[model samples]
Target: MRELKPWLDLIFKRPGRLVVGGFLILATLLSGIALLAVSGWFITETALVGLLLAAGVAATINLYVPGGAIRFFAVSRTVFRYLERVYNHDTVLRLLTDIRVALFRRLSQASRIRRGELSGAQWLSRLTSDVDALDTLYLRLIAPAALAGLVTLAVVVLAAVLFDVGTALLVGLLLVIALLIATVGVYLRTWRLSARQSDRQEDLRTAVIEHIEGFPELTAAGRTGKHAAWLMRQAHQVTSEQAKADTRVGWHLAGSHLLVNLSAVVALWAGFALFQAGTVSGPVLVLLPIALLGLAEVYAMLPDAFGKLGATLASASRLNRDCREDKQPGTPKAAGLPPETALLAENISVKHSGYAPLFTRFNLEIESGERVGILGHSGSGKSSLADVLAGLLRHAHGSLARTDCVYLTQKTVLFEDTLRANLLLGSPEASDTELWGILEQMELAERFATEPDQLDTWLGSAGSRLSGGEARRVALARVLLNPAPLVILDEPFTGLDAETRGRVSKRMETLLEGKTVISLAHGSEALPGTDRVIYLSG
Candidate 1:
């Protein structure tokens, strides 16, 4: 229901769509009534061939009116559809923005949670599948079903007045009963299937994503065949679950079609009996079936309509649970250190349930215009401290100073875009001269110089085609272009060779002149000219 609220709220947000949607509903019903009129003209004017021809002409004109109404109906439907996409897309994007912000916030605060805690597969599932689930709100059943129902109601009432009122009432009642019974049955059957399908889809998505991400590792370990088999198994499970869901939906639609046809036959038979008994005239008898035609169509369509609505509601329920469960941790206190104060962390500690403590009373202070090296063994809290200082992590116990910093993590993150675009991310207004200087500083200028397009060269998905070291250098250059007052680098020198590392270290030293730098390192090799060392031992 909560997931549905956003979509519903969107409809009411723009008053024009609501009013236009209602107008379309009325036009749809009047079109259906025009169909009945055309049929009646055929039956009543049969005695005079010439007059019947004239009535046929008049019926044609009446029928033409329905077409115009239908045109308006189509126009309104198209406009409403456009409005819905514009509104819903913007709304979902906004929600995604919030989720992204929160995810980064949690990553900063939750020290014990490694990137591995939410594996690539899990993150992919959340970003793509879980986020995609919200489509049920706008793209599925609500608007069409509501419009169809209202139009059906108006047509039914019109038919009742035009034909024998008793028979019209009886057909409407039967339709209601038929719709209610079918809807409940379809809901129960599809509910279980849809839920299972959603679960299996997530499982398959997770497995496939993980398998792809771990491809290099699996190949190196000679376990490629094993990973392939595991992926196939997940695919099989997803297919089986999807098949079951589809089968259930198909059966429900088939049964609903059968019942609707049966009801139509019964209604026609009853009308015939009334005609024979002199209770209804021939024209009126013909009118009875004409009126019931709309009901027949409605009955046929209603089951699927209701089924999809049920699926959408189920998706909404899942979204609500996820949003509620993953609420952000405690609001972090704003960093208290003065803006000009380089960087400071006083007795910062982080502890988590069911995990080893990440940091214990860790303390560090850096004056502006200083280069400091943070050295520690693997898991000695170097990366974690960098995260805390950069406002990406929150320590349970600490007072940290505020300082502008550009953080570069170990995993060189880049969008599938041109080199210039990625570098421009930090400072879009940077001049070409500044960019070339930074590239030279990172010792990545040679690669750019050799490229056919230099800075404009396309770096495909996460810079996959580039060597690990090159990707790292490019990311570093991007941060350098940003020129933050403070820079926090984690394992920045890992992938570089000896000569390149030396050049980069020298450039970093010069760049840090009169600036504060906090770098996490495995050893002092990358420290070049830093004057201070903070060793943390866990």
Candidate 2:
């Protein structure tokens, strides 16, 4: 329940929109109840007057008022229903955008160190299903629950005015019990099943993706069928849990409806005594019972909404946990350094959370306009060191400072946009001539020049349309375009052949002549020219 507080706050930000939407919903409900109750009253009045006239005893009746009210209620119900759907659906769209933006912003600000902990499948589930659960919180749970309580109380008040205080009190008690069964009872019974169902679905999806991705290996090992059977079992478990939740919701819904009907029956039975004692007329008695029965509509949506409340809370918990920023306080002091120092590291320790330290009391200083290379074998944390210098990651037990820098990571990341767009991210103001110049230096100009759109050509997803070496060069070119005083490259020539790497390396050295550079790789051959070289032993 506490997990929902933040999301509830987000929903309530548009208080005016929520108020209007809620008013529309409430109007729809009241009109529906009134339509039924008034029609019942009118029918009874007509019947009694008809009987009196048939017995040669004239009894006057007003047809126009009740008929007009029934017509107005019926028309108002339709108009309000249409308006609520249109307005609330629009509200839902705006809220969806708001929630997604907020989640994305939080994710962007989350610690880079912890971002690797979650898989793509888990993120997809959070963005889609978890977000979906939260955005509907107001519409499905809060608004409906509030409207039901209000309408139920109104029905009780009607009983009190038209019938007696004792009768209204009894009706209110029964309706209150019904409301509890629909909400709290449904939640208690289905909570565990509903809460974990999303996790099961995510697990199943991840497993399926992994299996498909490794299908070739499994086929060669003669174990594909067995693995698939395991996936089937997991899927069955998820489905079983979902079915159990639905069944519990159904049962609670049945019980709540039963209570509501019993309340209506009790109202009718009690109303008969009032009518015999001349406390309530025949039409008024019929009206109270009909109104009580109309409350079933209000209670009907509650059981299902509260049944999924557990899942919504679980979704909120997962989002909160996943998006937390890791802000580890530094234990080592590095307060001062020479102004010429482009980068300084003093007594810095580096490691991932929950892993052994990669570097202990490590230190380095790179002067302005000096190039340095750090070499290490695979798993030696060369990339981690690069990340620390690039400011993409924080180091524990250390303080560090560096000039503004552009970093090319070991992995090439390009969005599904134009080649021009991808490069512009590095230097947003770079013109066509500058971009083409960098592309030519990387020896990619002739390749893209043959394309229909050249720099404007779509890169496809993650630059998938380009070959490995081409994509690597494009990422490198983007970094090179940046005018930052410092540059950090992690395996910058990855996927290029020896010949291509040599040409690109020489070109990069020329283009990067004046910048302070730190290039990290597994071997010296993979590095650009450097004034000093450090070999890390791990």
Candidate 3:
């Protein structure tokens, strides 16, 4: 929860927009209340005057003023409602942007330290669904609660001026009780239900993702039906939890409505008593009930808003845990070294969280303009070594010094964007000619040249439009564009055929001529023109 301070600060940084949005919300709620009250008084007064005139009694009344005031409030309510939606939505969108940026930045920094705790599905949920839940905090919770309070205060003051201090106190007390029932009572009763529903929803999401991604494996293993049954069970569980939550929310809403109606009835009875005592005029007495009715609209949303608090807090807590870094005492820090020395490690030992040490008393060094190949068997720390050198993993004990390096992991990542746009991630200032140059170096120039749009072709989500081999080449091309002196390629040609691998390996040697390259692969034959090879075995 404390990790949320940075995001909260970012949201309130632009107080002007927040203040204006709040003012618009307040204006809309108040205008609606005023419109109903004024309409009621005008109609009652006009009817009484008409009756007096019919009895041959002259009555002096100004219809123009009340009629104009009603018109003003009616128009203002509609206009303010529209403006409030537009302005508040815009503010929410801006806040979402800031939150996403802050969350991504924090995750990027803490990923190396908290890698074990953040699985693929959990990471996806935190970045997308969890971050999105925050909008409800502003739009649904804070804004509506604020508007209800403001309207309640206005109604109490109006009641006092129209009737007496005792009437004002009664109205205020009822409104306060209604608010407490909607917020505190609903929260206390429904929070556990909301949390259960949220948990089931996440389980359903994970189950569906697994079913889709593992469809081929399940079919091959003759367990497709079993997997399908499991998915159905998860779906049923989510539906059951959702039903329970909805039932609780329905009851809470019904109770809130009853309280609001009770308040309105009490206001009406008090107004009637004042009228019989001749303390309040007929028009004012009619206005009181209508104004109370308007208040129902404000209080109606409180039950659901408060019911969502549990889920919102749960999301915040999860995101905070993922984003916050846990620094270990006495953790080894990389030493500063000369730019010409690409890497140096002495007596280094590394281990994953809750796992045995992968590298014990390991020593390695690479100079500038050197190409080194790391060959190891499965579970022999090939990829782990790359991660450590790239500063993506912290070693438990080591004296390591390295220049900045660019890493191309086993999985190729491409966005839903033009080829040029993806390439620009490596070198933002690179021009079209430079991008094409790198593509040619990676043997992908002919593939894009045949496309109708060339560099402007839209690579569908996750580069789904490209073949596996083509996507790998694009990733390699992007890596080639990076200006970092030390380049780490982890299983770069996994899906390519033997012939293609040879061509790509040769081209990589040519493209990475002046840079320090550390190629991690299963066999030394995969790396061409390797100056040296280090084989790791347990």
lDDT of 2 by residue, 71-143 (tens): 9999999999999999998998888888888888877766666677888777778888889989889899999
Winning model by lDDT: 2
lDDT of 1: 0.65
Q: Write the per-residue lDDT of candidate 1 for residues 352-457, one digit (tens) a residue.
A: 5466778877777677877788888887777766767776566768677656788888668989999889999889999888888888888778878899999899
- Note the clash tally of each candidate: 4, 0, 0
Candidates ranked by lDDT: 2, 3, 1
List ranges where model 1 is wrong by over 4 Å.
3-116, 181-184, 211-241, 262-288, 294-335, 338-340, 431-433
- State which candidate, 1 or 2, has the greater lDDT: 2
For model 1, state the Cα shift of residue 120 in Å.
Answer: 2.0
lDDT by residue (tens digit), candidate 3, 194-253: 766676677677767777788899899999998889888878877887677667777877
* Model 3, C-alpha of 340: deviation from truth (Å): 3.6
The number of the candidate with the highest TM-score is: 3
TM values, all candidates: 0.78, 0.91, 0.93
The TM-score between candidate 1 and the true structure equals: 0.78
| Residue pairs with backbone overlap in model 1 | 108-392, 108-393, 108-394, 109-394
